[model samples]
Target: MDDPVSAQRASSVRRSLASIVLGFELIVVFLATLVIFGLSDLPAWVTLGGGALLCLIMVGTLGLLRYNWAYGVGWAVQVVMVATGFLNPAMFFVGALFAGMWTYCMITGSRIDRQNK
Candidate 1:
């Protein structure tokens, strides 16, 4: 019989890796909202609304991790993070950094999956 443990590890490497990075990225965005884009700098509604939207995306990504299409949603979230630079310039650098990390995880994770299989 095939080794189930090895098989499961390979499957997880391919999928869950991106989700892990995304979860971290969401937290970073939340912190940046409060620190980099301070409450006094922006309107209360934008700050609260943006924070709420990020929370929703994070939860949705967590709940949808089992599906392949959820990765598409993950990419969309990445773009949103990068776009937030429009409000807080510092996010441009932070977002780009995470985007690179996310890309690396997806590519390397997929390669590991193929190799293990």
Candidate 2:
């Protein structure tokens, strides 16, 4: 029989670590959105609306991390983040940095979960 306690602990650790990383990304992306607002000539509504949408995606992705598809969604989020560079070129660097962090979180978190199990 499988050990429920062990399984639960692993899930807890994975979710906790995943949330931490995604939470940091959420903040960074929000800030980037604000920066885009100020720097880009993109219409005000688009700036605010797009930023709001990105934040929503981040929140959804964070909450849905327990599901396997959430990671796929996260990668899509990363693409959108990087694509923002079309408006603010600096975000290319910022987005890539966060993308790397996200990659690390996924890889390291998975390894930790495996080790714990």
TM-score of 2: 0.86
* Alpha-carbon TM-score of each model against the true structure: 0.82, 0.86
lDDT of 1 by residue, 1-117 (tens): 889875684467856787678778878877877774463478777787887788688788877766778878878877888898888788889889888888898889879877876
Q: Would you list the C-alpha lDDT of every candidate in the order shown? A: 0.78, 0.83
Instruction: Give the C-alpha miss distance for residue 28 in model 2, angstroms.
Output: 1.4
Clashing pairs in 2: none
Tens-place lDDT per residue, model 2, 28-88, is 8889878888888889899989998989988988878778788888889889888988898
lDDT, candidate 2, residue 87?
Answer: 90
Q: Lowest summed lDDT over 10 consecutive residues: which window, candidate 1?
A: 32-41
Q: Candidate 2: lDDT over CA atoms?
A: 0.83
Backbone clashes in candidate 1 total: 0
Error of 2 at 20 (Å): 1.4
